[model samples]
Target: MRILILTHRVPFPQNGGYPIVVGNTIKGLVSMGHEVSLISINVKKHSGRQHERDDLLNKISYTEYGIDTHISVLEVFSNLFTRNPYNINKYYDAGFEKLVLQNIKDNHYDVVQLEGLFVGPYVAAIRKNTTAKLIYRAHNIEHQVWHRLAHQKNDPFKKWYLNLLARRVKKYELELLNQFDGIAVFTGEDKNAMESFGAEIPLCVVPIGVDMGKYQPEPDKTECPSLFFLGSLDWLPNREGIEWFIENFHKEIVDGDLKVKFYVAGNSIPEDFDEYDVPDKVFIQGEVDDALEFVNSKSIMIVPLLSGGGMRVKIVEGMAMKKCIISTTIGAEGINFAHGDNIIIANNAGEFYDALKRCIADEWYCREIGENARKLVEQEHDVNKVTRDLVAFYQSVI
Candidate 1:
């Protein structure tokens, strides 16, 4: 099958969550004897420089277009009156639209996969220009993330703005449902949410996948108890989560005289992090070369997300590396994680502290949970099996 993937960012490098999903899916499709072509916006934040590759397609093969993704004070004021969410309009690229139309008409693709809701606006052009089956690959219920964020925020103005944006996104998400031929959601919970939003289209839960062969666990584990939170710092949820942890949990744990060290790694570390009275125990390493290597080096992984949707690709990677993980329930959502078995679920600051303390106290139990995590990923989240099922899903829709 010939598949064309539409993404909002360059899918190469595969460092972040969005790219990891897109890149891994492309790799899986190609390995499974399918022709995969991608069309992506060259958003500067997501772009990785030139590199050598053996794949048939790379950055050069895709029709990449640049767009102004930044929002000024004036743009924010103007967005209040616009019907479309500011998030969606920021990615509007005329050249991208034209290239998508041309690509659809020129290439005979069996399926055109839209990677996220932001790219849903191009469905009309795709439908008109091609007879391919349009698949909406939903990363998450987008509005749910904003709604959760709104609730978590304390500032009145920010809360109001987030609530307004959430409403707009929800309306747009519902309207996008009937526009696609089929929907591929990242989680069963997201699938159920779509159905509740009046989605009647054929849909399947196609979770994010990892190449098991590439993510081998470390033979010699770290003996010391250390926690690390790894994710894209540019993402609001991750930034907020880490900040909350440092303020509410990290300080207390360290102040109480615990011998635990915390590490942070991700791209685009905000400048304001310097202002915060971050503890001496916390090391903020901005963007490492190898994400898997960083994860393997750590004894325990942490996902302290308070507001976000979709499975955390990092959590899946951590599981693949057989790292004992402590995450909030919201953070573990969509991954179907077991509380005491595969992962440790901590809802509040105290719970988070307690979970980490337990991990530190019982080294043998931590190792047991890490092994359980690896077993779960092997059974459910393997990329080869996932793509094979996805191909069958494509056939069903066709």
Candidate 2:
């Protein structure tokens, strides 16, 4: 089958879960001998000087890691006039869809994979022109993430406006789902979440996979009892997760008798955002390029996410790295694993503190739990197995 996949980000480098999922999915499809072409949406948040901008313009933009890569970077003109959030501008088009339409007409693919709801509008018209099947990969309920941000924001006017905008966008996003032939969700819970939002489309679950070889527990243990939190901080949930960790976990653990340094690292932290202290116990090393290496270097991975959709792929990554997890119940959601078995879950400050202590001091327990967790990821989230299942789902839909 000849498939055309569209994504909201460059899926190479796999710094964030969305890219990791899309990049690996393309690999799986290509391995099955299906001809795949990718059209990744590049929403570049330029943090550069005028000379740097000129340099960026000259930089070689190459085809990323899909089978037959077709990259198209998009920029918005209205962005000059509008100060809308990344959650909005990331999906906003600057005529890339026209090129996509032209390409679709020329190639006439067997299937068109839409990566997220943000790209829904672009592909809605693609269906009208072609006889190809459309697979809408809803990474998460996009509106819910915005809603969480609205609630978390202290500024009343901003919170109210964000919430209102989310409600409006969600209605549109929900309507767009019906435009596609099949909708794929990260978790069963997400599929159900969509249904609760009145999504009537045919939906299936495609769980994210772990590259077991790269992430699985190594023979050598980490040197220090360091707690780690990793994700692309540009995402609201990751920021919230770490922010919550600092407020809740850092407060209780910083002055405590236990001596464990905490590392908060991820990708693409905006400079305007505060990179402050958590009582000298926490180091906010925002956006580490190599996540698994960072995860392995830590004794425990702490996830204090309050609200978000879909599975925590990082938790699975941490599990693969044999780092005992200290996460909120919400943070640990969607991965088909039990609390005490594969990970250690905590809801609040006290419980998180306790989980951290257990992971820090108890070497034997850590080894056993970490080993078991690694095994669980291998059994349940092996990339090859999950990819096969995803292929089966696509085959069924086709």
Each model's TM-score?
0.95, 0.85
How do the residues 116-200 of candidate 2 rate in per-residue lDDT, one tens digit apiece? 7767767657877788888888878888877977888889987987787677668777767677778888888889887887767
True-structure RMSD, every candidate: 1.9, 6.0
User: What residue pairs clash in candidate 2, if any at all?
Assistant: 266-287, 267-287
Using lDDT as the measure, the top candidate is: 1
Strongest candidate by TM-score? 1
lDDT of 1 by residue, 279-366 (tens): 6776778788888888888888888899999888989999988899999988888887889999999989778778888897887888
| Backbone clashes under 3 angstroms, per model | 0, 2
Q: Candidate 2: lDDT over CA atoms? A: 0.71
Q: Score each candidate by Cα lDDT.
A: 0.84, 0.71
Question: Runs in model 1 with CA error above 4 Å?
Answer: 47-61, 219-223, 275-280
In angstroms, how far off is 336's CA in candidate 2? 1.4
